[model samples]
Target: MRLDEYVDDIEQDDSVALRKLAEEKSYAVTEYIDDARTRFDETLTDDTLVGSTAPSVFVGRSSYPNVSAGVLAPVGDENDAEAYATTGEWYQQGFSIDDVFERRTGLLNSTRRSNVDVYDVWDGFVGTQREVALADDPVDIELGLDDRPGFDLDGPLEDIAAPRGPRAFAESARVTENPSVPRAIEKTLSDDDWRAEGAITYLYRRGFDVYDINNVLSVGALGEAENRRLVPTRWSITAVDDTVGQYLRGTIRNAPPIDRTLVWHTSYMGNDYWVVAAPGDWEFELLELKAPGSIWNPDPDGQLYMAADNEGYDGRSGYVEETSGAYYAARLGVLEALADRDRQAKVFVVRYATEAYWAPVGVWQIRESVRDAFDGEPAVAETFHDAVRQLVPQLPVSMAALRRKSTMAAGVQADLSAFGAGGDSSRSR
Candidate 1:
């Protein structure tokens, strides 16, 4: 019998497939570091510091008018600083959460509390801002700090596992040497009236990735005068995703549909994803399965939890509360792939979070994983429902539950009924 026929047995009793999932989630440590716990040893002292390229910026989320904003650079050789936060390097090397934390924990953040609307050049902070915003390459910087910085490891969902280094309130910062800036970025920054959204879209079209754009925005480097402010790091992440996704959606609004039902599957960092692209309009849905004992569902005796949210052809005006940032990030990846093919489709993405995904790596994993999933050879089916059925075995959740939570699946089922009732239409929305 097919796997679905034994759903009851699989749910109540241990199965081979489930055992395999458990094994995959297990981590293999080659060696243990005794100093791993000593890394957090912070001394409450201040002194002049020099570091390399500006890898990132952090905007603290607290207090309405006054918030802490900082530039992040690793305390290491100038050349290695660029590699510290490079997402491509991290993904290419197959670095785990601990590997990332090991590097990130060494970064020294020079911060200052300023009004959210403080975009004008200041005596001390402006120099740091200019270097971070416009530098084509990492530059040497000297910083004077008030005291030994505190470690910040606090964040939501995915960011909760991110390692943060020591942060000190900045007394002053000065560049040791002038750094080269990209002509395009320099021009955009020169225009004080340019809107942040426009600047982001322009740079993205010019091949600048979201990582670079978020840093710039967080440093208050974009947007028109009177509208510019330091955006919190968490907020900037979603902003960039939303901005890029919107741009892609505009391009595919009138595009043609794909030729057939396509199913693509990929997994990384313990999260498994199956995406179905069916010939239709630009509608999208995300169904998430958090298995019991998974990071998100830590209780071994707890039942599995499934959540989903979707948008229609026109897209949503409000936030996607259920899936949060992953919704926009994954949606952008799908839309970009569809736009590249010059075809639009009703996209359904199903994500399975197993115990293997014990650590949070942020939403970039979702965005990139879904994007890479499209690179593989797809399994084709004649209809949307057929495609879902073909891929259902990969998920631990029951089909009945998935259908209830997946708007796209229900639409496909309804269209099937309409076809049987003598109506010839197969597309929904």
Candidate 2:
């Protein structure tokens, strides 16, 4: 029977698929680490790292007002420093989870304790770090560390950043060459009266990706000169995503809505994404189901962990608490896709994390997954409720569970008794 016509109770078993993917990922990670170690030089037993290409800068929020401002540079392949920089292009290049880990693990974060205010301070370690962030390409740098850098891979993973590698306290940092600054960025930097939000929107409209904007914003490069202050990299990432997402949302506010309900699906880094776009005014919801053994839900015997957050046509007033950064990342992706089509949608995006998603490789994948979800032809449905019913059995959670967490799902409970009287259904695929 067609999924929308008949309701049934079914549980998906992805154990075999998970096992195969796990084995492949394990092999790839091991091989990548081995290759990296071969190219990585350990001779920096001294406190100085020389001739490294500074690809990015990180501002840590560990101490609040007093932060850890640092530069991120590749240790060995100094010539290819730009590859270590995080960008959405990594997704376009088809970077696997292991590839992301390997790239991030190759760069060392050299930091120095400093106040969050660095808008006018330019001549020291912080200045050098800002220069790297402002540069269009990797800048050659020399870093004098307080001690030998520590390489530890056993720390807890981050949802907003890739697996970072070595770390050290930088006593001094020097830029060896002139970093090329793009004109758009230069213009933003020169505008003393421009607010950060306005500058962010301007940059997005001027063809700057969120990744670059995040980097620049983290170093206190944007905003009115007096109000500019360093922002932590983690905060900057989500901030840029949200800022740009709001811009895209405004761009599509007056556009026509989609004519039909469309469903698209894609998988990346062991997570499966299902995006449903229905004809309506602007609305977005993200529903996440993490398998028991997934990174976020690590207890093998625990129940599935589900989280959801949503916004109406007017947009969210406060931050999304349950889904956090993933909400903004995924929302930005859907909005970008909608903006390109010159249309708006009531977007419901579901992410199912299988046990194979063992590592937390940050929220970039979430953004990329939804952005590319529309690449192929989508399943068409007559109604949004029909689309939800069609995908219910394939989800890890039951229809009831989804309805509990999803406002949109709850609104369509008129046929409750019909859906409640369910029968067993075979796997159609």
Candidate 3:
């Protein structure tokens, strides 16, 4: 019987035993919902990346030659063979790793909605800036100290140093001289070690399944001299409570006993979405929700929730929250494409996924506005933006944020100078 109905009966007879059971169930259900709210967001790069750790790159070691100014010299093939493969210009993934559509075919396309999405092929790797002569120096022109007439042998080096002509490692942050290259590299270098993990690989790792790391992640990359490498973005979202963990433990149908506190989340949004190696013929993609707080809960808000296998997409046009029409349109954008493509051609890019979509720290206000607006509607499965317009309406489109109010005019967005809930939304937004 429903808890409400059972409670009514207990009330009519004042039965203590019945009351106890209803109360117990009520707590369980609420806790369940909270845990269920917890979800893993890999598309975070699409909407994450804060601080100076931006995705933008400065020109060579010196600001003199802006890297953005198209200075990559033609990458010569090994041995400079005229008929050999030529390295292409460096570029970002067509889409942010965090993106996906609600309906993902094991082999087709995917989308990332309101949730943070991204992938971590390797962890603890750092974003690098090399100390180079040009890659490191400032862009200012240095007129060679107008020929100081004479050379002095009796003077200190400081008196003879002419502002150190064009610093070899000026614009760069980390530089290693040729003599400094570690005499003995503790590790062997290989493109195979840079393998990218897909949904299948993720599951395999989770299941204690072992495989060759290189075979699964990256294949052979361009020659060692190319100096072309990628610095994967690491993402994390936090929540407000322990309820999220509880919910995660019980939410997924057949999950292992969850013990990780969900303080942050790991994204799956990246160069590719799913893994190809897992043997199981189960359902769609491999998106497991993680809680930096507890592997159980997936809600960034901390209200215990479990969103395993759930996919969220930002619902907005470039910046405006996707109006009902746009929301549905975003969904339809994928669904219509999928429907038209029969069984095999289900995969196609609706919007060419770009690194700009993933790296947001340096975006213009307009760009940020769109990203923020779309975050309001985190559901991607509800395609046809028109169909899901109701998901977000007058729901604090501005930064006032969402809070339960006694009346529409109540201070849902007011400062917590006087409070019912705590200050940080992570605790009770």
Candidate 4:
């Protein structure tokens, strides 16, 4: 028997084929949809507006700002001319890539496996990373007072946004397309590439007291009275060895100076993507307390190609740099990460500082099409100023195109800071 024949109300009842037939008349549907946005026929399995990859807001874990900007502002407000500002006002929010792109199907997918309660953030994080490792049914991460209604107050990982600069890329505002051109970093990692790191086993081996910490992870005992950091009371250390001891790790007892930190996100709202942390993301004020090379800048002139994967942040001290060579050399390492994944290419660098934060920055692309126009090396830049100096005199340079690089650099900076070792300030802006 035909399924349509079994339906009592064709107008009220919908099906996949029937919905496709309806959407065939897109002109009429657009007019009807304008009357009501969420008017999708529940029964229609294929109800969609051409399946876009545009950005969208997540449920229950969105809109969490009012976060202090940095650990210690290097420059205090105008009133304190001498001392750096201890706190900077931040504004951040996040949007999903699925809601932004209509063609977000097999070609570009926003999907992943996650323990996070919110569907969008999980899918968004997984979509960008391709693969992720979640602890079990329950996710981990800390939270703040501003996270009452819209954030994950019960865990340690409260996905949030970044403060927007004068030129920031928020979620296309309401799902937009670049008519001129679209620039993106192509990413492809298969099972062989993203192997399991055995995070649970690794933790126990390092003397991480999971059984003792679960209590702290449970009801989020670390949650603040008002603006307190969200620390869980007791959480089952997923996949721990059976032969575990009842003793606590020395790090927790402060036997040898140890620090505890959390990782989160903050952003300009709606249109921010994920990234690994970098030294430049650290505030100059906090960096002062630590040694010169304590903070690590991910997008150094050399490590530009490597997409920021995650961060290691602490609520107390700032990020610790990868102690190795000269500061700029380490900076170069970060830039080159994404410099030439497969082939060699020239890159430009640019820094932005307008009564806000300032740091080393860059831009780069392969010299494939230009026919050796740049020769073996197009042009190399270490600082933001040097990068802009080379690209600016291009005569008829696409202003919007250049702007995209700046936005991308900003994203790299934000993500690096979000995941770096310090402040763990990923939840708010």
* Pairs with steric clashes in candidate 2: none
Please report, in order, the local distance difference test score of every candidate based on alpha carbons: 0.70, 0.82, 0.19, 0.20
Q: How much is 45 displaced in model 1, in angstroms?
A: 9.0
Which has the higher TM-score value, candidate number 1 or candidate number 4? 1
TM-score versus the correct structure, for each prediction: 0.83, 0.90, 0.18, 0.20
**Best candidate, TM-score-wise?**
2
lDDT of 1 by residue, 1-429 (tens): 322332222231223444454454323111111132243232222354444466556788898568887777765434677776646557657666556556666677788887787677645675476576567677677777776556544333344444456677888877777778787787777788998888989988998888788777776778898777778878888899889888888899999899888877777766778888889899999888786766777776677677788988888899987988889888988988998898999999988887666656678788888988888777677788776765655566545555666777665453323323311112110
Report the lDDT tens digits of candidate 3 across residue range 1-429: 322232233222222332343234324333422322231122112322211111112222222212211111101111221111111110112121111111010000010011111122121111122111112121111111112111121233223211111111112122123212111111112332422222223322243111111111111111132332321111000010111212222233242222211111111121111111111111111111122222123223454211212112211123222121222222322222222322111111111111112222111111122222222212222222211122112111111222221111121234433232222334222
Candidate 1 global lDDT: 0.70
Query: What residue runs in model 2 are displaced by over 4 Å at the alpha carbon?
Result: 1-18, 21-47, 154-162, 414-429
Error of 3 at 408 (Å): 28
Per-residue lDDT tens digits for candidate 4, residues 1-429, read 121221222232222433343234334323333322222222113322121221111111122221111101001121321111000111111111211111111111122123332222312332222111112111111111111111111221111121111111111111122222101101101112321123222343454333322222221111222322211111122212111211111112222220211111111111111111222222110000111111122222222111111121111122224321111222232222322222111122222111111111111101011111212222223343333322333212222323332332332222222233222222111
What TM value does model 3 have?
Answer: 0.18
Candidate 1, 278: how far from true, in Å?
0.5
Q: How much lDDT does candidate 2 score?
A: 0.82
Q: Whole-model lDDT for model 3 versus the true structure?
A: 0.19
- Candidate 1 backbone collisions, by pair: 53-138, 149-167, 196-223
